[model samples]
Target: MDLNKIHNIYFIGIGGIGMSAIARYFSANGKKVAGYDKVKTPITNSLEELGIRVHFEDGVKHIDLAFLNKEKTIVVYTPAVPSDHQELTYFKNNAYTVLKRSEILGEITKNTFCLGVAGTHGKTTTSAILGHIMEPLKATSFLGGISENYNSNLILGDDKVSVVEADEFDRSFLRLSPNIACITSMDPDHLDIYDKPDALQESFKEFAGKVTDTLIVAEGLPLEGLTYGFGDSAAYQALNIEIKNGGYFFHVKTPTRLIKEIEFYLPGRHNLMNALAAFAIADVYGVSSDVIKKQLASFKGVKRRFSYKVKSEKIVLIDDYAHHPTEIKAVEASVREMYPGKKVLAVFQPHLFSRTRDFIEDFANSLSKFDEVLLLDIYPARELPIKGVTSGWLMEKMTLQNRKLISKVNLSEEVLKSEADVVVMIGAGDIGLMVDDVKFRLEEKFSLLK
Candidate 1:
C-alpha cells in the first residue's frame, strides 16, 4: 500500500472526470501513467498532452510489457468499468496491486492536510472553490472538474493542504481521512448503488465520522456536521445577499467574525452554499477575511456549470452540468432570478437509465419550472436501455405545454424557431459537445431574425 514505492500507474475507464483527475495526479508526480477509455474525449486528450499514454481499445494485448508488472505498477479502475473489462481481468489474473480511484485518492491525500468535499450535488463546485482559495496559499488540490479560475483540475503545490471532491459513488468518500470536509445538499441519488435515501445518508454519516477536525454541512442536509447555511443554526452562514452586476453579493458569517460583501460570481442558492463551505474551511485555516473575500469574488467557476456560451441583452445562452432533479431546480431558480419575466427555454438530456427510472417524477417536476422545455433521449451512460424508461415517458409527464422530445438531429431546428428570451442547456452527458453547435446555429438564425 506504499504509493511512493510504486512507479507505474494504469487506469481503466480513464475518461471519467474523477478517474482523469487521479490520472493527472499520478502523471504530475512523475509516475508512468496510462489508461484505457471506450471513447476519446477532451479530458483524455488533456491527459495525453501531459504525456500520459491513453488508448481507446479494450484489448489487453496493447498494454506495454513494462506496465504489466504486478509489483511496481499500481492499477486504478473506475466503478463504471465493466466486470468483464479486459485490462481489469488481466490485472486481476496477474496479481497486480489494484485499487479503486477512491482508494488511491485516500492513500494520496492521507499524508497531507486533506480538505474533502462530499455530497450528492455541489461537491465539484465546493471543492473547486476551496481549491482556488488554498491554491493561492500553496495547496495541492484534486478536483472533480476543471476549474475555470486555474484552467486545470489538478492543482499542484508543495504545501500540505489538499482540496478534493470526496465522491459518494461506490462509497468512495469513506476511504478518505480528511482534516476538514463539507457536505452540500445530500439528495437521494445513485439509487442503483444505495437502493434508498437512508442508505446513502448512512454512508454520508460514515464518511463524516472520519473528519479529524471541521465538517460543514449544507443549509438543510440531515447530518451531524457543523451546519453551514444562510441562517444562525450553521457555524458558517451567508446573509444580507444582494445581486449586483449579474452575480451574487452576500456576507459569510463564521463563528468568530463575519466577512461582509463577499462577491461570488457563481449563481444559485446552491452556489451560495458552496461559497459558505469554502469560506468556512479557509476561515478555520487562518486565511484572512480579505483573502476569502477576494478569492470568492474572483473565483471564475467550474466548466459546464452555468458556463456562459453566449451572453447579450438580445440573446443569452447558459450551459450547465445539472443532471439531478435538485440541481435542475437550483439552476432554474438561478435562471429566473437572473432574467426576470424573460421566456426561458431549458434543454435537458437525462443521463443514465437507472437515474431516469428512479427520479422520473422529480425530474418532471423540476424541468417543468422553465417556460419552455426540450428533452433529448436519455444518454444511458452505462446501463442497458430500460423498458418503459425513455425521454418520451419523461416528456409526457411534463406540465409544460411548450415541452417536447426532440432528436439530436432536429434539435437545432427546433431551437431556431423557438421564441425564448434565455436559452439554457443542462446535462452531464456528452450533450455538452453540442453546445458550440447549438450556439453557432442560434447565432446564424438570430442574425436572420434580426
Candidate 2:
C-alpha cells in the first residue's frame, strides 16, 4: 500500500522497541501516529512526549476516531499482540489496511539501498554501527535499538542508503531486499515458530539470497558469503587488537586494503565482529575507510546490547538484552575479560516459555559460567506458559552451585546480600527497570568495606 494515501498510523503494540522506532519514523515522516499498548512504560511515555498518542488500554473504545477511517488510516500490529486484541479486531473488521511492522519496514526500505543486519544476537549493535556509519555518509537508517551516539533510534539522511536491523523473529528479515547485508549468527532461536535448528538455518540461507551485492557473515556462520573475522582467512579480518581505555583498537585488512587502528567502545569479540560486518557493508556502499574508521570510533553502541548501568571502583553492574544462550556466553566472556578474578554474579530472567523449553540445557550451561546465578520467573512474552518449562524448572538443570529462583520482589534483596564485585542483570524483559535501583543501592554508599 502507498503510504502517501494514508494519513493516520495506528500501532497495536506501540511500546515495543521495533514498533516505537517505526512509530517515530511515521511521525517524523508527517503521518499522524497513535497507538494502543497493553501497559504504560518508559517507551510509552517517551512516545507520548513525542506527540504520539498512546493509550494503555487494549479496548477498541479507546481508539481515536481518526483511526476509524479505513481508507485514510493504516493499522500496524506486532506479532506479540494477542490474536484476540480488541483494537486489532476492530481494525480487521472495519476493513482498515493492517500490516505487520516487517511489511512496513519492507515498504520503507524497498526503494532505498538497504543494508540489512540479520542474526540472533548482534543485529542491534551491527545495525546501529552501520546506521551511524551510513548517516554521516548521507544514508538514512532505521535501527532496532537506540544508538547512544545519536541519542535516537531513527537517523535521517539523504535517500541514497538505508540501514535496518533485519530481525529473524517470525521470519521478519525475509521482508527486506538489501543491496548488502550481514548475518552475525545463525544460532537456533524462536523454536516456537521454527520448530527446529535446521529450519532456522534454512531461513538464513534464504535470507542470504536476497542481497543483490555482497553478504558478509561472521567467520563460522553457515551462510556462504564474503566473510569477516579475527581469523586470517576471512575476506575482511581484524587483527592486532588491543583494548585501550575500554575501547577496542584494531587493524583490519580487507581483500583490497589494510586499515590500521580503528576503534569502538562496545567490548567483546562479538562487537569486534559486529564492527567488521558494519565496516564491510559501509565500505561496499562507497564510504571511505577513513570515514568508516572515524565513525566507528565515535559510534556509541545500542541500548541494552551491552549497556553499562552501573560502574564503580569496587562494583561493575551491566544490564544486557541477551536472552539466548549464545548471547549470554558473549556477555559472560566480555565481563570476565574486563574484570578478571572478580566474582561475577548474573541475575537472569528467562523470556518466553517456548524459548525457555527450547534451550533449557544450553541456558543452564551458559548460566553456570557465572560465580553466582539468580533466576527469575519466565517472562511469557507472546507465549502461554508451558508445563514444566518455568524458570525454576530451568534452574534445576543448571550446573551452577549458587542458583536461586527468586521473584522480582525479592530479587533486590537477594542482590543486596550478594558478595560479588561484578553484577550482571541479563534478559530481554522488563527486568531492566531494576538496573537503576540496583545501581543506586550499589553506589558509593555500598563501597567495599574491606
Candidate 3:
C-alpha cells in the first residue's frame, strides 16, 4: 500500500498514546485524520483541538463517509481493541486498508534511520531521551508516553531519522526495521498473550535479530550485543553514579572516551540504565559526547513515568505508570531513597485482572514495601473480571497491615485524609487521570487542616 495514494488515515483506538501520535503525524502531513475511542481523555481532547475528529462511540455510523472509501483511506487500530469492536468489524468486512498501529509505524520507519527502543519497561523514557537527542537533527518520534519536554507524544521532524518505542505486546516490535536498536530489559510480561516466560523471551530474541545496525542490550540480557550498564565490562558504562539535586549525576564511559559529569533529572538506578541505552544509541549515530551529555540533562522525562505533581514541603505527591512488579519496586526504592524516614503511601490501581492474577505474589511483595497501600478495583482495560482475582484479593495477600482496598469514588476522600508524608500514585490505568483532582483535593484538605 503506497502511502502517497492514501488521503485519509482513520484510527480505531485514536486516543491511545501511540495511536494519537500517528494520527498527529498523518494530520500534519496533509492526510485527513479522525477516529474512535471508548472514552474522552486529555489525549482525545488534544486530538480534537488539532482538528482531527474523535468520537467516543463504537458504532460504524459515527465514522465519517469520507473514511468509508476503502481505496483512499487507511484504517489503523491498536491490538488492544476488542475483536468484536463494531467499527473494526465494519472496516474488515468492507475491505478497507486496515493496519495495526505497529504495522503503520513499521512502514513509517522502514526507510528512515530508525532508532527502536524495546523492553518490558523503560522504553518510553529511553525513547523520549533518544528522541530529544536526535531532535536537533530533525528526527520524528512516536512515543508511548507524552514527553514533558515536548508536551506531546509525537515529535515531528523530517523523515530522515525516527525514534520509536518498539512495543512487545502482540509481537508488535518484530514488525519494526530499526537501523539501530536497544533492548533495556526483556522481563516476562503480557503472559495472557505469551502464555509462558520463555515464549516472551523468544519474541524479544526474534526482534533483536531484525535490527539492521547496532543492537544495544542491558548488561545481563542473554543476547550478545553492545552492552550498557554500571559495571566495567559493558561497552557503554555509567560509572561513579551519585545522587545530587534530587537527580542523578553520572558519567558515561563510551568505547571511545570518558564523557564526564552528565546530569540526569530523573531518579532511580533503573533510569540510569535507560539513560545509558540512549547514550549508546546516540553515540552510534556519531553524536558528540558533549552534545549527548547536554541533551540528557535537559531531558525532562515522560508524563506519568515518575512524574511529580506536588513537590512542596507541606505535601509531596508523585504519579507513575508503573504496573509491573519490577517497575513498582523501582518506584518504591526511588521514593524511599529521596524521602527517607517519611511515611510513604502508595495508591495502586491494578491494570488488568490477568496481570494481577499472574503476578499476585510479586505485586504483594512490592506493595508491602510501602508504609501504607491503598488499592482501587482493577481497571479491566480489555478483559472481563476474573473469577477470584481482585484488588481486594491482592491487598489481602500483602503482608502490610496498613493496606486498604477502596473504590475510585472514595479514592479522593481517602487520600485527602491520609497522614502519610509522601503519596505516590502507581498504575497504568485510568488512575492517572485522577492525579490532578487528587492533588487539588489534597491541597484544599491541607488548607482546611491548617
lDDT of 2 by residue, 1-450 (tens): 677888999999998888998898889888999998888988889889999999988787888888888778888989989888888887888777899999999998898888899998898998899888887667777888878887777887766678889989899999999989989888888888898659999999899999999888888887788998888799999989999898899898988989998888888888888888999988877889888988998987887888887777777888899999999999999998888899999999999998888888999999999999999899987777788888888888999889998998888788988999899999988888888877777774476333
lDDT of 2 at 72: 89
Clashing pairs in 2: none
Q: RMSDs, each prediction?
A: 1.7, 1.8, 1.4
TM-score preference between candidates 1 and 3, better one: 3
> Residue 223 CA error for candidate 1 (Å)?
2.3
Best-to-worst ranking by lDDT:
3, 2, 1
- Position 129, candidate 1: lDDT: 93
> How does each model score on TM-score?
0.97, 0.97, 0.98
lDDT of all the models against the reference? 0.87, 0.87, 0.92
Tens digits of per-residue lDDT for model 3 on 269-380? 8887888999999999888877888899899999999899888788899999999999999999989888989999999999999999999999999999999999999999
User: Where in model 1 is the C-alpha error above 4 Å?
Assistant: 447-450
Question: For candidate 2, which ten residues in a row score worst on lDDT?
Answer: 441-450
Question: Candidate 2: where are CA atoms >4 Å away?
Answer: 447-450
Backbone clash pairs for candidate 3 read: none
What value does the lDDT take at residue 340 in candidate 3? 87
